[model samples]
Target: MLHTVNKSPFDSHSLQTCLGLAKAGSDILLIEDAVYAAMSGTAVTSMVESAMNSSTIYALEPDLKARGIGSEKMISGINLVGYDGFVELAVTNDKVQSWL
Candidate 1:
């Protein structure tokens, strides 16, 4: 499955909730404000790191750049994807779930 989370972890638990229930080997795509979770050293960094153990995590590159989070600032294991990559992930997964 592919999980897409667009909310900021700072203001929403949707990211955490998604991570908690995500299937093993699924992919999690962070879009919009949720890209903040991809950065290292944040309050939710541990959660993000933990999720990486079970899931392949990614952040939308354009979204991260818009929020002033460069690829260099993201957590080491997180992958950065553009619009095309996002579409690719969506197609690769068996299903797509968007966390509000």
Candidate 2:
């Protein structure tokens, strides 16, 4: 499954809920403000790291750049993807569950 989270962890529990319900081996695509959770020093860092153990995590590059978050600011192992990559992921996965 491809789980897309667009809410900021600092503002909502949607990311946490997605991480909790996402099965092992699922793909997590962080978009919009959710990219904040993938930053190195955020409060949700530990939770993101924990989720990494069971899921392949990704973040939208455009969204990160829009928020002034560079690739260097991202946590280790979280892949950065462009819009095409996002489309590829969507096509690759059987389903997409968006956490609004």
Candidate 3:
């Protein structure tokens, strides 16, 4: 999943969706402003952590830095991946979907 939402409302639902998929053994690829979830102490942060506790989760690097959430500041488990990483996940996953 390439979650692109930036707002808290969107993050809540998007984070939940990612966690649902992850609990089922799926991975998540967050894009655009969704990278904020990688930050520490945010609502989405805990959500990402829960998802990661079960499955793989990544955030787009460009998105993270664009919004000022650098890799150094990312919560413990959120992996920051590049564009090539996105391609890899798309090719490796059983399916792909975008969340607005």
Span of 10 residues, lowest total lDDT, candidate 2: 65-74
* TM-score list, all predictions: 0.96, 0.97, 0.79
Full-model lDDT for every candidate: 0.92, 0.95, 0.67
Arrange candidates by TM-score, highest first: which order? 2, 1, 3
Best by lDDT: 2
Best by TM-score, which number? Answer: 2
The alpha-carbon deviation from the true structure for residue 14 of candidate 1, after best TM-score superposition, in angstroms, is 0.3
Error of 2 at 78 (Å): 0.4
Task: State the lDDT at 81 in candidate 1.
Answer: 93
On lDDT, the stronger of 2 and 3 is 2
Instruction: Please provide, for model 1 over 1-100, each residue's C-alpha lDDT reduced to its tens digit, 9 standing for 90 to 100.
Output: 9999999999999998998899899999999999999998889999899889999999999999898997678889899899999999988897999998
Q: What is the C-alpha RMSD of each candidate to the true structure, in Å?
A: 0.7, 0.6, 2.7
Cα deviation of 28, candidate 1, in Å: 0.2
lDDT of 2 at 6: 97
Judge candidate 1 against the unseen true structure and give its global Cα lDDT, from 0 to 1: 0.92
Candidate 1 TM-score to native? 0.96
lDDT string for model 2 (32-73, tens) is 999999899888899999999999999999999999998788
